[model samples]
Target: MKNLFFLGEIMSDISVEELAVILEEDDKWLTENYNKLIQQYPGQMVAINDGKVVAVGREVRDYCAARQKAGLVGPLLINVPHPDDLEPFLI
Candidate 1:
């Protein structure tokens, strides 16, 4: 299961149109990095910021806390399972 996190995009100041744009951009980032991420972090969680990977870990909370401490508010956090065991919500 891949989970996505957006940083500043979630701020209250953003309007509905802005939110949609942010989501669309985030989606593109994920799609563009999908294959590379799977090959690099098979069966692990990866943290990405601005389309660059920040870290890879087995535990979600631990990795997220690290990113937060490093001042990364919103990162694309994805769990890359086995290639054959693709998560149904990927699309």
Candidate 2:
């Protein structure tokens, strides 16, 4: 079922369920390779597709564009920040 999204919202071509599966794959990959990503891609953007690392770059748009240019669709893009790069909660 295609739900209506408001204008200006950046929507993916895939449905919510598909996105959830992709996110789950991303989470699994992160779980298995947390240390590697922090060391390799600290403060950078990375894209994962089909439970594999597809692209790595400094900017999200650039990498995603590169992936698109390579004909990849609906990749899960995430920022792998440095281990010490943390944000504290404030009221």
Candidate 3:
């Protein structure tokens, strides 16, 4: 709570343990309040890359895939526009 702040659009950085504690207390509350908190803080990036565990490349992909398999709504990826599609993207 002390070191929490917003960095940019749809991003946040907070202590993982603090988040875990909040999640444990009331997952529903966390879900419901997520947007409000982000709005107040604005541009922020949450870092989940601390501690003993580390995920990279395939591992990250696999983790996301597993979540999707479990029926979780994962993050969306914007497709890179090729040279041919640049006009459309710009427009």
Choose the strongest candidate by lDDT.
1
Q: Give the alpha carbon lDDT tens digit for every residue of 1-91 in model 3.
A: 3323212222235465855553454434434555453443233332122221111123334544544454432222111123443357565
Go through the candidates in order and give each one's C-alpha lDDT. 0.70, 0.67, 0.34
**Best by TM-score, which number?**
2
* Candidate 3 clash pair list: 6-43, 7-43, 7-44, 8-43, 8-44, 11-44, 11-45, 12-44, 12-45, 12-46
| TM-score against truth, every candidate | 0.65, 0.68, 0.22
Can you write out model 1's per-residue Cα lDDT over 1-91, one digit (the tens) per residue? Answer: 3265444543566576966665667678878879888877888887766667787788877776778678765566777766767767568
Model 1 / residue 37 / CA error / Å: 0.8
Model 2 TM: 0.68
Model 3 spans with C-alpha error above 4 angstroms? 1-22, 45-91
Q: What C-alpha lDDT does candidate 2 achieve relative to the native structure?
A: 0.67
Worst 10 residues of 2 by lDDT: 1-10
Our tally of clashes for model 1 stands at 0
Which candidate model has the greater TM-score, 2 or 3?
2
